[model samples]
Target chain A: MRIEAGRASRRYWQDLWTYRELLGFLAWRDLSVRYKQTALGVAWAVIRPAFTMLVFIAFRKLAALPPSGVPDAILVLSAVLPWQLFSTAFSEVSGCLVGNANLISKVYFPRFLVPLAAMATSVIDFMVTLAMLALVMAWFGYAPTDKVVMLPLFVVLAACLALGAGVFFAALNVQFRDFRYVVPFVVQAGLFVSPVAFTLGDVPEAWRWLVALNPVTGIIEGFRWCLLGANAPFYPLATLTSVAITLAMFALGVWYFRRTERGFADVI
Target chain B: MSDIVIRAENLGKKYRISHETAQPYRTFRETLAKGFQRRRGSAHQEEEFWALRGVDFEIRRGDVVGVIGRNGAGKSTLLKILSRITEPTTGYVDLNGRVASLLEVGTGFHPELTGRENVYLNGSILGMRREEVRRKFDEIVSFAEVERFIDMPVKRYSSGMYMRLAFSVAAHLEPEILIVDEVLAVGDSAFQKKCLGRMEEVSAGGRTVLFVSHNLGTLLSICDKGILLDAGGCVANGNIRSVVKAYQQKAGSGEDLAPNLIGGPLKSVTFRQVWINGEKLGGSQFSPGEPIQIRVVGNAAEHLPEAVFTLSLYAEGGRLFTVEDRPMTLHQGEFSLQVEIPAGLLRPGDYSLALGARTAAELATPHDWCWGTDLASFELNEVWSANCKRDLHGMINVNARFTRENAPILERAAT
Candidate 1:
């Protein structure tokens, strides 16, 4: 058993590098396909959040909720920005396995690469949205806060959280196709549950812990707190949850994905 | 001992033949209970069918092997294992070099992409590097005869054009081992000839090839070694001709050719073994054009006479040139006819005979009773070539006069 494990591990290492080309190919293919026949092309990346920002502004002005960003401008832009990244990254990564049935069957690649490639392509969209966000911030003349130095760390945490959950959903999608439908619903619900538009202070004091337990809630609020410096760094606790959950979800996702991957070519 | 490139030991792959009929619209609870109960109670619910069992073989560098079998005979499954499309359920395989397969044309092609884009994508999928695809890119387009349509979208190309382009990319993209499955079966004869020439070039370049095809004639010319698989395992592994012979013999001997005496909806059936009669008829010698009794025995469960039928014979070489005629005039009962055996119709060889009984209609379902029993084995002991060399195209040999001035005129005027 010991010798077999050694050999298998060595094989896995070789396969990882050997399948790198496939990884790049899948990533490029997905990116090309996303904008292939579309009218807006790469601008769709900008349109989704830009329109969502407008909707948020209308809500903020109409309802008069306590403001997060620069009232009708920068605050809604920053909040909608991360929330869009979170939604797109996780969904694309999860849908990757089900989408590329052709590649999965004919070739031997690290199954994780399928979802990882989607996750990577999504970062391109994330970068574009981030670029747009910076422009929005400049337009509103919102200066950086001291906590802004820590914003990169929060973005990394959000990526990890998305990656970990993305892997699990990819595995589940293979076993049960209904996860495709479940994923959109989860993302929609997440938009409301996280403090995307409102401040966490609005929720009752008794419900604070339950609301903070949401990994993205902490990351989104952390994004606002670090960038704006209006709210306190509740991140110390949320960081613990995000890191711990990301680590656990990562390990679980890899294990589950590998276990189910053995049967993929045959069944798919 | 030309450096062995691939080796397999006790290689086997088993699949659970899922009887789709058994699983109905039952609930998950019911399915779980039934599955467990079936697993414990009856060993029959799950039948382990090994596509390949204990296959041990080695291929050296530059060897071409033809893996031949009937449908469901594990040919494709074995290719899948070697190509690493699926893992073997047991044992292991070791290979020293890369393997690529053209199992289906345009396998990795994106229809929305342009023909030029698909060429790169498909070429890479077959294990070719980008530089290699670029180097051979022009040659591939020219060979596929689709140079004009390179910029066009693949989805818009007709099926034939798509296949031609796909085949060109696959053939041009280099690999140490080329595994092709029935790709040559498509395309026009001229195009088939082109594909064969490309395969010959691949073989000459000292690359190993494993071609899976049902065309015995094609395989006999290309493959050096042959592997004949049946049901679950290799039955014969050796030279190409001998393996083909073994497969032919197995197919011929295993069938029950005799028509049932108590026939029903079956319009016209031959009771006697056609080949057995041919054997007893003084060993298959007939005057150039002679009258022969075409015998058939069947009862008219209901009388009808517009049941047109024809008896056909094909030599062991897959030649379908011989036919004994029974014109479209219905018959519903025990009937036999003496049809003329057109002189010089057959050449000297073993042949299998089959009979077809069809009713003439727009959407008529022809009652065909073809078998090893209806087979007529015959040989042409003498052929009066009559100052012309014989040809290798079709089944029947025809006799005609050639007038010098009219020859070219006839050729020009021919339909």
Candidate 2:
């Protein structure tokens, strides 16, 4: 192996690809350890979004809010699936670097793998939540149109947005621990603002564009459109904006992560 | 000649040494206060410390190189730079073929994971491919001798078992170059011996190995070449014997004679120097059945009404044998203490002396007034005499007198 200093060295990405097996092992370790001691086991993954869906359903019923013409449970579950994935990915990825300080300080691998593998656990949890969403749709006697085939693309888009935000925060979290406190607030606040409980149509027409800035806003709505059928509004411009924002954040996140990657061992 | 497997030229690593203690996750209030302090020009100053500087070396294939240094002597920094855990501030190193570094055993082993899982995890962390780990899995499991509990979580394993499992995985790693740092210090002596045997086997297989350790005997025995680091620079690089000898000489030179004063000067007393047989002690070697006199010199800023001076002798394995603890009142200014050891009291082995002083006021508390650890070291060798031979059994020597029962009395031997 040839070792060199500086950020522009070409071996970094190649090293990442070379160490792909480590990424899989780390992700497996995280998934196995996550539910090891808990009584609920993997049920905790579904319990979180299930509880949130119920609370949102009650709130919608009490407020007598105008329904988006889809079953409230199905609507809430579809949006919650993608939103939970984003939130979990964000939180887990942001803390991954610091959480695995022992591995980072002692070993040589692409530092990006830590956060990327951590995000993999969140992806597994997203899969479990997706299964629960399918069951919820079945219980409500809702049949998805052929548009549901696009659900995977929306999930990928959400993952991209989460990973971008995660990589950015994971790197920042190492330098300034203040992000440890900042990330939770962002995740919690993001849940309310990203249209998880209600559709984007519930918001005023002028403010809909503002909501599109949340990167996940387009993803969650796209999920509702795909699963809840064509009646669910698909704002082409808003989705484009969200996709652009997600890609930009991902680019910036990867750039910032790589830029600061070398100093991680020293600072962390 | 074998190919040069590793070559490092002018490698330097600079670290920012902050005067303040490192705290993880500082609260916003502290950060804000520090920011304000920085704006007002009262920020804590940081100095650039070069952990490694201009370190140049080459190791050919199949070379077992030992790295020797005192603490903070950049031994670990060089290993870290070589392992690529940390980048050098300047220069570069060319390493041929796959490189695996075992900076510490079980680098990524999760406590909750089973022994089998951890073995694979640790192997991959050390740069082994999954297929390779699988092929070597049974060998690792058998070598670790934890087959019965392979499925059990490692948290349930004894520390020795954990270390063995971790070391076995690392040892089985077939990387062309292996960099190990002080891992043999763990585990019991038997396990340590096993690890040494494994390392010897690896070197015999004609692979490059870079070993960093404080155990000079083991390092000298296993390695053909040695690199000595002192203050972030390569001081000696040659055959293991001479480099180890130079390192030993440097360590024994009494350059750090002044006792590290604990707390502040106001507490009470501080040790200045220790002497043996009217000469300043500097880790000198001695022989068994020899009389020795030790003198401790120190300063007492204020009169100590009730001070207890204690001298402790420690064996190589850190077994403490208190030689003396005398209570004496010391007036202000310099004070000297003398202790005598009789002949045949110490066996043939290495020992260290620790000096400490405590006051009556602090006797009930746990803290000591002033203390110095490893102040001096001396080795005792076995010597033969006309009448009797030196004993070579244990750390202590006992002079026993015997008389025959129900028989004619024998003449006493000359003293």
Candidate 3:
């Protein structure tokens, strides 16, 4: 490998692949450390989304919104699962660089893997919650179309959206720790802005486009369509827009992260 | 793909020191304020500080090279660049093989994780693959001697156990090139010996090693090549002995390098000057088996019934032995005392002298009227003899007579 003034080594991506086991170990470490001290352990994964589903069910009843013909609980959950995954992954990715300051400053690896490992931890939590989602569906006697097979694709989309924004913020956090405050504000405010509690159809048609700009909007809608089958709403243009925006954010995140990554060890 | 495993060319690193704030990181408010100031025609209050500049070196496979210098001499910056922990601002470095650096031990260890789990986590952070760690797992655990606590959380282990476990994992790593800095100073003497032995074994296996430490003795024993950095530049490089000699000479000279003789007002006497062999003492080499005289010149403000003079000899910063002359009455005036070390008392090595003076009554207490540590440093060169090998280990040497005796032998009776 050649280390030069202005560019990372040409083998950075190859090194990233070669160090895949590190990615796994780091993610496993976070997961293990996270659960080791907690009273509920991994059960928190299931409990978190389950509690959010309950809150949305009460909101649905109080708002007296039009039903989309599917079970009210399943409707909010399909979107909530993807939304929780995106939010958790985003928060983890954004703050990971500072969180692993010891590793970043002392060792040499593809530093991007630090945030990527955080995403992996969230992905593991999402899997556990997905299992819980299935059990909830069974409890509600709801079985859907073969479209559920395509569910993994939407999951990937949510991951891309999370990683793209997370990487961008993670890099920013390293420079100006002020982003530490900005990140939580973005995640908390994001829940209400995205269609987690209500379907996209509930919004006034004139303001729907603005809501779709969140990038998570299209992925969550796609998730609902995949789970709710023919009864759920599927907007191809909005879904396509979310995919495009997610890809752009992913590219932009990586570009900004790479431009700033070299100085991380020095400043962090 | 020549024999050289690493090469650096004209490397440099520059950091901007902002006078506005001493914090290592900038906050959003400071950045915003700076932006407004830029618009108002105020020049940025920042100075470019080059921690390292125009440095170059190369190392071949199996070369154990030592990097030595005073503090802030760019020793760490140079190592950080070589290890790719940070990038150099100018020039470039090329490495022909995989490199693993241990700038610190247990860098990624989690206190909540058990020792067994941490081994895997720490190994991966140090660039070892899961399969590699798995294969060497037993060896690492046994080497650390924490077999009974492998499943226990590392936070529960004693600090010694932590260091042992950390060092053991590093010792088992098989990177093509290894870089380490000041880690051996943590463990006990026996553990340090084991670590030094392990390092020797690593070098023997033909792996390139770059090491930095303040212990000159350890450096001399392990490194065949040396690079001396002075003020961010390479002053000398080549054979370890000569580079070390150059460093010692540079460190030994200068105005403040002289003996420290300042004392409190409670003292009635003080050593104004010291000499060796009737010459002003300085950093110089001396031969063994020669009568070496250290003379101390001092003045007494009042008469002391019983004044004692003492001199201590130290090797590598550790006191080797001390001698005291018989107490004698002193008049109120200048007085001088001389202590001579007779022949065949010291082995070939480096040493320093500390001078002390006190009344016999004060000698019983820790208070000495006149005291100065490291008043002078000298080296004893090896003198080849017809019957003895040169450079025999230990601090002091003595003369002994060997004789053979003939006697009657007694037979053992079986019962």
- Whose lDDT is greatest here? 3
lDDT by residue for model 3 (B22-111), tens: 787899899999999999989999899898888888899999999988778889888888888899999988898989999998889999
Better of 2 and 3 by TM-score: 3
The C-alpha stretches of model 1 lying farther than 4 A from their native spots are: A1-9, A61-63, A145-153, A229-234, B18-46, B256-415
Instruction: List the global CA lDDT of all models.
Output: 0.69, 0.83, 0.84
Candidate 3: segments with Cα more than 4 A from true spot: B257-283, B290-343, B351-378, B384-393, B399-415
- State the lDDT at A160 in candidate 1: 76
True contacts kept of 3: 0.82
TM-score of chain A of each: 0.89, 0.96, 0.97
Candidate 2, which CAPRI tier?
Answer: medium
State candidate 3's TM-score.
0.86
Write the number of the candidate with greater lDDT, choosing between 1 and 3. Answer: 3
Give the alpha carbon lDDT tens digit for every residue of A1-268 in model 3: 6778887878778978988999989989888888887888989999989899999999999999898888888998898899999999999999999999998888889998899889877899899988988988899899978998989899999999899999999998998999999989988998999898888889999988888887889999999888988887787867988999999999999999999999999998
Query: Residue by residue across A1-268, what tens digits does model 2's lDDT show?
Result: 5666783458778878989999999999999999998899999989999999999999889878896778899988888889889889889998999999999889988888898899888899999998998898899888899998998998889888888988898898887888899999998889888888778888899898899877788888898889988659887866898799999999999999999888888878
* Of candidates 3 and 2, the better by DockQ: 3
Candidate 3 iRMSD in angstroms: 0.8
lDDT of 1 by residue, A145-204 (tens): 887898888778778777778878877776566678888999999988877666576678
